[model samples]
Target chain A: MIQRRHALTVRVTHWINAVALILLLMSGLQIFNAHPSLYWGPSSYTGAGPIFELAGGFPSWLTIPGTQWLAMGRRWHFFFAWILVINGLAYLIFSIATHHVTRDLAPTRSDWRSIGRSIADHLRLRHPQGEAATRYNVLQKLSYIAVIFVLLPLMVLTGWSMSPRLDSVWPGWVDIFGGRQSARTLHFVIAWLLVLFFFIHVFEVIVTGFWNNLRSMITGRYRIEHEQR
Target chain B: MASGGVLLSACDAASRNPHVTKVLSIGEFLSQHVQHAVTSRTALAQEFTEADLSPEFRSNGTDYPDSAEYRALAMNGFVDWRLRVDGLVERPVELSLDQLRAMRSRTQITRHDCVEGWSAIGKWTGTPLSEVLALVHPLADARYVMFYSADPMDDWGTRYYESIDMEDAYHPQTILAYALNDATLPIPNGAPLRLRLERQLGYKMAKYLMHIELVDSFARIHGGKGGYWEDEGYEWYAGI
Candidate 1:
């Protein structure tokens, strides 16, 4: 049966988030290519020996400017950063105000208990049947909660810590993250984690039911397949 | 999906074209405005201890001036060198290295964050630019302070230069540094003098300084941008 699934707000915000994150990652890579190294503590420079260094430049296909264009990369990064922050804020406010957080994303005692089983089911490529397909699995809810509440906020904070001016207003942020370089390293790591999540998310969409999930996200309508169990 | 296609195409176009970088300069303008709104005009950059200094502070961009005139000055240990402060000032003045050293000075250990994604800490000693500006007394129309360097950034003899707004100019930490690590400035590190703009990136701190010009606006300067790098696409307000 075809039914309403994602809300218009969710669908719109999801697309906006997807675009923003992609832009951020691309531009971030371009920015990183400017130095091609990551460090710890308050200070780092050439001959200081970075904790991690990316030898050779990131391929043009992956970076925004597609060359060593730090200036242009910064422009792209900062432009989209505002968009990401604003959209994320709107999403957070609307989700909480509409009880979307509590009703859909929040985990319950039963959800916690079912998580282990859900993992097993996911490992076995088992798709939920009938009505179960309409409701989010416990694992889905938990990951969403983690992404929304933890990772995204951390990304924003770490990103803020790297700013020279912002550090003046909130030096505590740099301290909290260990230092500017630490914040930058953490920002890079967390972004990669989000990239990992994106891949898995896409895979899940394809494996479970590509058109059904795609239609739900785009048109707010999902078709649930009825199968004998 | 349709909208996503449109969005992706737009991004693709932006990525492919170099001129798109100019179009995106509006983002820099907006960011600069927002940063200004949030940060206090007099907010100071973090200062560190002597122990925090890097083993080697990397000399960025042009380390030495290739110009023959600058070389002759360097050969004589910059004793004959004078930093000419002129343009839109009540009293145009030229102060030699000795004269600058004689002025009231400030010493602070601070971190220098380069736009190329590196940082290093070093102790700096210099006369506060405000004190020097007070000596010259800039006119009412003077809104920006431009630092012209002796270093030829390219083969074309285009001297490296940078500028800052009046707010940054008057900041306590903004100084004409002539010493590093309790010694005279090294040739590799903008010796004789350098502009220490603590709040901005390394590039904004013009090294190998030779001239100070007070201007109503930087629009008439090279490339009509505030600095050499800014002319090369870097943001003028690099507060971040």
Candidate 2:
């Protein structure tokens, strides 16, 4: 019996990050009073554009109906942003110091094949390949890599696009996103994508064997059937 | 539903996309409810210490409205122009710039987050909107207030108007502003008169304001959507 791995710091960080992302998303939606329209295809909402008024001090009565809640939403968002940033930095520092990031998150050659097989198996498109699965399956590695590298960085960059100072400090970032308005739109769309990713991830876990997958994340060890090998 | 009542057909278009529209409507409703509960007809938009204030607060939309009449008012120190308050009020009144200046005022330092994804912080000073509304004596049926501007915005030619429910109207921080950063309102900043509905997105604070009308509802307004952007599918209530 390969003993189950004990709870590790990365697991804690991952769960914390997941929770923080949820809060960030909910608060962000509340603040997204600028353009509330959603389109199905190529047609878009014009209110998606930008309107620059440096320091807002308008009578609430002058506003349309939904903006008042956004006021409180913005306050929570600012405070929560600081928490997320600090938490992320701390996770990064700890991961680097412990070499956990390189050892665990880095993909091996065999991982690509196994991950692909796992995806096929999960979709019921292929039979499970016989192999002695180690700590994490192939799908887990890919998801982890994408979340850490692609989604996390995109979120941070897009979030910063809203800063007026960003244009002065990192003109390149604003330019990369086309313009501030485009960046804002991208930020919101990406946020929605992440939310979609989160739901799918949770659903997959439940479908695959909720207790088995969940326990591994919590206790750091999952059982594999001897016959599968 | 009545013929002369606020026309609500545009709202029928808005209702077609209900999920988005519902969220937008809820925001507007909440602002009104909160504004009504607050004392002094104003609520402080969030406040900030000196450290939070940005070095520059970029102006948006029209820094200075291009209308010739408004330019004349600006050139002459805005002494002649008056802010009119009528519509659903029992006592219609007009206030000169000086009289508005003499009223009690508040100064706040807050952040302005633009829809275009940029933000800045600045200090603003203005008379509470509650004080001005009080002068007109809003009737009991007046559930919403409308703001009309002299500036023509985009294709929404001639008038720039916005309406909010009474609750937000009474927020303590809600103001009919005449100053920015301790100076008289700049021409580009809706000088001589502008509204600062703190707690909303930037566009809600329409500048170069001309009239305030009290109404039972917003359905009869142009496009029947409460604001220029609202007419064009932007969320009617841009709170935060």
Number of the top-ranking candidate, with TM-score as the measure: 1
DockQ of 1: 0.49
Segments of candidate 1 deviating more than 4 angstroms: A45-48, A227-229, B1-23
The C-alpha TM-scores of every prediction are 0.94, 0.53
Q: Pairs clashing in candidate 1?
A: none
In lDDT terms, how accurate is model 2?
0.65
Model 2 achieves a DockQ score of 0.04
lDDT of 1 at A7: 91
lDDT of 1 by residue, B206-240 (tens): 99988999999999889999999999878998977
User: Which candidate gets the maximum lDDT versus the true structure?
Assistant: 1
Candidate DockQ scores, in order = 0.49, 0.04
Per-candidate local distance difference test: 0.87, 0.65
Model 2 chain A is weakest, by summed lDDT over 10 consecutive residues, at: A38-47
